[model samples]
Structures are given as structure tokens and as C-alpha cells.
Target chain A: MAEQSITSKPQSLKSSYWKAISAIVWKDLVAELRSRESISAMLVFSLLVILIFNFALELDIGTRRTVTAGVLWSTFAFAGTLGLNRSMAVEKERDCLDGLLLSPVDRSAIYFGKAISNLTFMLIMEVIVLPIYSVLYNINLFNPGLLLVILLGSIGYTAVGTLLASMAVQTRTRDLMLPILLFPVVLPILIAAVKASSGFLSGANINDIFPWLRLLIAYDVIFIALAFMVFDYVVEE
Target chain B: MKTKPRTLIALDILALILLGVSSYLALVFAPTEATMGQVQRIFYFHVATAWVGMLGFIAAGISGIIFLVTRNLKWDRVEVASVEISLVFFFITIVLGSIWARPIWNTWWTWDPRLTTATITELIYIAYFMLRQGIEDPDRRARFGAIYTLIGSVSVPITFMSIRLYRTIHPVVIGTQSAEAQGGFNMTSDMRFAFFFALISFTIIFVDLFWNRIRLGALADKVELLKLKVMQ
Candidate 1:
């Protein structure tokens, strides 16, 4: 029976493949928009982090200049972790992940869909935090280069974050496992992102900032390809 | 049990002899560095341990691939043995490096590339154990362990590259390049021979220990199955 299906209708394969991807993405987005539970939790968690950083780092005028990028990015990174862990845990809890796996969809499609949804939640929280941070610190963080850095950093961050979180959620200490499993591996990305963003914000030359951007891009491409290829192993029952 | 496995007993005696000779060559035979005198001797074992650690890492990664291909538990045992020994040896390497660094670099730690990679690789192995701990089923544990090791092996190099780039932009004081060029004396021919020989000797020791540990794992699995059957 499986062999007969393989022999028949190979052309329909390409279209249904994409159809599966969009369906998964659409499912996550619609569910998120209706419930707003994941985004709201992430958004609130990010604000609390900024608030704590403001007081903890003594985000004074001078300190803010140095720490603004670090504080903001770390906040997003931490809260983005919350969203990723919950995102996977929710699917696993609802048995939706199993259903998705059982469907005719390609496994990579599920990876992309979850990654895209996770990236969206992270970006939304970052977007909200940016304006509040700018208004609070009175530091303009709206620069194009800085925005580019954020996008590249988040892409790389979410690419690996989703993969690791999927593994973590299956573990006994699901929620606690993500950060422990993640921070060490992704240290390079966070370090480069903060440095590059700070450099751009401080009006450093493009030459000074370009290498970091290159690192971020390289990380994003490598891990994205890695996650795509290895998604099969991770999600297989 | 078959009478103590003559080959392993032979390997053990050989390893001990080589290790003793290597230590003597490193400490007494090799001439001391003019700048950093006694601490430099630690480099012989430090580099040797690091080399063995790398060997274990490669073994674990290959075992991971083999496990996935064959879906066999024996390769999983090989993977765990490699990771555990690699973890221990890498810890020794890192500490010995620190001890050597203190008198030589005047700091206990420097984010040198090899040192940083050592730390990251240690973390990777620790995570490997943690992932295995989380699963109850042996098969699933083995699968996840193999997959994580494969992913980690690929990522660790990229991690090293990024850190190296960071180091280039901000070269720490007492890094290997400048320290060797400035303060470190040239290695005598005897020292060079001992150094490479120490690496080869440790490689053999690592293989012997790895075989023993894999046997231990197999015994543990046997006991676990027996316990399960008795409970039933």
C-alpha cells in the first residue's frame, strides 16, 4: 500500500509539500491571534526584564549608552526562550505535534512552521520593547543597521532555539532544560549581536560593525540549514 | 569472567610504563624554560590530555553516526563511554591549563581559542549526559543522545571560530602566539619527541579505558534487564 502510493502521483508532491507548510504556519498564527496567550506572556515577560534592567543596571544616562543594546537583546533572548518552550510544550500537550507528524506533511514543513511562529512571537515582543526602551532611555534605537542586526540575530536565535527547545520539551525538565541547553551553544550569536548592535548605535564605522553582521548571517545560514536537515531525526517517533 | 583479559592487563602495564617515562622525560629530561620554569612541564600533560579529549570527541561523533545507521545499542554504549572519558580528560586539561597559565600568563584564565573550545566541548558532553538522563526508554535515550552529539559536534567548531574571531579583535594578554614568541623558549629535540610520544601514549590509554567503560555499560544494561524481568 505504501509502495503503491509512492508509485502514484509524484507530481502532486511539490504542491502538497508547500500546502502543508502554509497550513501549519497558518494554524499557529490563527491560534496565537485568537488566544494571544503566548505572545502576551512573552511581551509581559520582556517588559519586566527591561524594568529590572533599568533599576538593576542603574540605567543612568551614561550606563544606558553602554548597556542599552545588551539589556534589550538579553531581555528578548530570555523571553523569546519562554515563547519557544511554551510553543512546543503546547503542541506536545495538545497532541497537535503528533497529529502534525501523522499528517502527510513533510517534517521540515513542521520545523519551518514552528520556527516561523516562534520567530514572530519573538519579533513582536522585540518590537514592543524597542519603542518602550527608546522612550524610557531616550536613546534612539531605530537605526536601519541596528534593525538589520536585530533581524539577523533573531533569525539565527530562533532557528537554533526552536530546534533545541523541541528537544528540551521532550526531556523531563522540559522548561528548565532550554536555557541550560541553549545559552552555551548560542553564546557566539548573542555576543556578536550585542557588540554589533552597540557599535552601530554608537556611530561606529561600517568596517567595525560589518564583521559582526557577517558572523550573524553565517550563523543564521548554517544553523537554518542544519535545523532543516536534522529536523527529521528530532521529530521522528 | 574470563581471567582478567590478558590483553587489557598487558595494555594497562604498557600505559603505566609509558606514562611514567613520559612524566620523567617531561620533568627531568627536558630543559626548563628560562621565563616560566617548572609550570611549563604541565604543558606536556595538558596538551596530551587535550589530544586524548579530541580523540574521544571524534569517537563519540562517529559512534553517534553509527548508532543512527545501525540502530544498535552497542554503538550507544560506545558513544556514552567516549563522552564520559572525554569529559573527565577535558576537565583535567582545562584545570592543568589554568595551573600552567597562572605562573606563565600571571592570570588563572585567558579566553585563548584552545582553552575556550575545551570549555565548550566539556559543556557539550555534559549536555549529552543531561539529554540522556531525561529519557526513560533506552532506545529513545540512545536515539536522542546520538542526535544531540551529532548536532553538537557540528556546532562546536563554529563556536570556536566565532570565539577566535572575538579574540582576534581583542587579543588577550598572554595568549599563546605572543607569549610563545616573547617569553616561551624553543622546545629542545627531546622535548618535541616526548610531547608527541605523550600524545600517542595517552591515545592508547584512552582506547584501553574506553573499552573497559563500554564493557561496564554492557554489564549495567544486562543487570537492568534482569531487574525488569524479575519485577515482571
Candidate 2:
């Protein structure tokens, strides 16, 4: 009876830890669903970025073959920043962050919760953008490899982005702070993602694309661990 | 306020003398290269300043971690001092590299991995200062600053590796030269002497500047405290 009680204690703690994470995620999702603020902004902003790139790059057939990946990744990067800034700023503006912090849960649970929600928002935007991009450019971007790269890239981007966004919202220039702090750090993800996407779209050798996939996965793992370790420092009052 | 320490004063003078001697050794003592000629003289100072920049980069990253662990304001001062010194030295290295490249590579710039990584590192530090500027609380500013530096340091090495997927044309001086590397040259015994001397001298200079900067940071902290007291 004593052994069973001791073993069961850790099991319950583990479940409750996950419960805290999902609770925060559920709160964000429900709030976002009702408001539609972050998603609408990210979607419309990304579409505009694509339109601007069309005129700017003169994406004719030949250029499109080479630059489609670049254009798409750049659009996502800009729109990701917009969504990240809004997500954190909404918390700060209404004092939701303080209440969240006051709850009896580990701080890293907050980090994962925010990161997962940010990743979801970014994935939704990518889903909408990919089809529109394919239809307009007359290029099929539906390869399994391409989707894998997008998912991995968004995970790395949002993992770091969510951490930085939390810091940015507390600053005086909250809106301007996110991109300045984020772009240089996330350059690796953009480079690897663009390379892998282009390779898949161009029907290049699988061997050539595997290295970039490795880099994207490695980046996602390193940054998620780093952010989890240091998040407590960022949020401590 | 405390007076400047006697040791720092003496070390500053020694640094000045070493700088002059290192310049003399590099410009007059080292032989002219057959391929690059006099423009190759920039290599000595360029390499030395880049070494100093790298030293500060490591120092800032380590100090940032220590500051986060210790939660001590003194480590914050050390982090900021090293970052400032590194920022200036890296800019000098970039300009000097450009001057050498124009005559050698026939262009002002190319998107080589090292060159791009250096520029990106510079931008990251600039953004660090901008982040610090936006926060009013000193403790919060230091915390964010340390976190950002930690992030920048980790990301920079990965950035270099990712960019290395592309071919690099920058010359490999220390290691065996790749077949495709441009402007590669063999250093004579005298040139090695000058290069080593320059590296040592620049390291001393980096230490001197770092100490002075930390003292300045300490002074600034004192002023902030006094002002707060007056307000109360």
C-alpha cells in the first residue's frame, strides 16, 4: 500500500503538469476564436506581403521557379512577427499575464502553452498562404517534404518567438521590439526552410534536402530546450 | 567617486607602447607578399582586431550566463562592457576586411559565410542595445539583455554553419588552403613574427579597454543610485 501510494503521487503530478499546459493553451485558443484579432491580422498581412513581392520581384515563370520559396518564407517571417507581437501584447494590455503567473503551475508550462498556440496560429496562416500562392503562381507546392519543412520551421520560429515576445511586450516600444529582437536570431530557420522548400519544389535529390531537414529539426530542439530553461528568469517579478 | 587605479593607468600606457611597436613590426618588418603586395599588410591588424572581437564575444556570452546564474549586477556590467568593446572591434574588422577585399576579390563585398555571419552578429548586438533602451528598470533591462545575448551567441554559430552550405571564397590563412580559395599566400618567418606580436598586443589592449569600460559602468550605477536618493 505504501509503495503504491508513493508511485501514484508522481503519476498524478505528471498529469497535473500537462493539465496546466493544456489549460493555458485552451484559454488562448478560446479567446482567439472569439476575438479573431491575431489570425485576421496575420492572414491579411501575409497576403499583402505576397502581393508586394509579386510586383517587386517580377515573379515571371523563370524567376518563380527560383524565388517562390524565398518569397513565401519572407512573407511568413513578417507575418509571424505581427502575430507574435499581438499575442503577447494582448496579455500585457489586459494584465492577463500577471494572473497567469499567479497560478500554481510551473513557469515553463506557460512557455510551452504560449509556444504551442503561436505555432498553431502560424501553421494556420501557412495553410491559407500555400494554396493561394500555388494558384497564383501556377506551381504545385503540395509535396510531403515541403509540408514537413514548414512544420519544423514554424516550430523553431515560434519557440524562440514566443519567448522573445514575452520580453518585448513589457518594453516601451513593444510593437517595434519584436522584429528587431527576433530576425537575426531566427535567420538559420529561414535559410534552412527556404533551401529545403526549393529543393522539394524543384524535384531535387532527396539526399540534398535531408541536410536542411536535419538542421531545422536540430534548431527546433535546441531552442525549445533553451527557452524552457530560461523562461523562469524572464517572467519572475 | 573613486580615483582611477594606478595599475590601470600603467596598463593603459603599456598598451599604447605595444600598439605602436606592433604596427611598426607589421608595416616595416614584415616582407611584402608576392601576390597581394602592400595591401596584405592589412591582414595583420585585421586578423588581430578580429581575434579581439572574438575574445569579447566569448567573454560576453560567458558573463551573460554567469549573470543569469548569480543574479549579480556586477556580472551585468562585465557583460555590457565586453559587448561594447566587441561591437567596436568587429566594425573595425569589417571595414579593414572590405579594404583588403576590394583589391583582392575585385569587389567591395561578397556573401561569404564568415562575412555574412559577422554582419549578422553586429546587428544582433545593436538590437540588444535597443532592447535595453526600452526598459526603465535596471534589473529588468539587465535580465533581458543577458537573455538576448545568450540567444544571440547560440544562434550565431548555427547561422554560420547553415550559411556554410554555400561555397566560400574567403582565403584560409591558418589551415590548409582549399583549392578554390582566392588570395591564399604562404607566410614567411618574419610575417609570422609580426602576426603573433600583433595578436598578443591586441589581446592586452582588449583587457585594458574592458577594465576601463567596467569601471565606467560602475560609475554610472553610482550616479543612478544618487539620483534616486535625491528624488526620495
Please, what are the lDDT tens digits per residue for candidate 1 over residues B1-232?
3345788889889888888988888889877866678877887898899888888999999999999889999999999999999999999998987897776677788776667778888887888788788888788788878878887787788778776665432122223544232235567788787788888889888988998898889888988988999999
Cα lDDT of model 1 by residue, A80-162, tens digit: 88899988998989787899899877899899989988888888888888988899889999999888998999999999999
- The segments of candidate 1 whose C-alpha lies over 4 angstroms from its true place after superposition are A1-11, B1-4, B168-183
Local accuracy by lDDT, each model: 0.83, 0.93
| lDDT tens per residue, model 2, B1-232 | 6899999999999999999999999999999999899999999999999999999999999999999999999999999999999999999999999999999999989999989999998999999999999999989999999999999999999999999998889898998777778988989999999999999999999999999999999999999999999999
Q: Taking the tens digit of each residue's C-alpha lDDT, what string does model 2 give over A1-237?
A: 423433354456677677778777777888999999999999999999999999999999999999999999999999999989988988887799999899988999999989999999999999999999999999999999999999999999999999999999889998899999999999999999999999999999999999999999999999999999999989998
| CAPRI band for model 2 | high
Q: Every prediction's TM-score for the first chain?
A: 0.93, 0.95
Query: Model 2, which residues run further than 4 Å from truth?
Result: A1-11
Best of the candidates, TM-score = 2
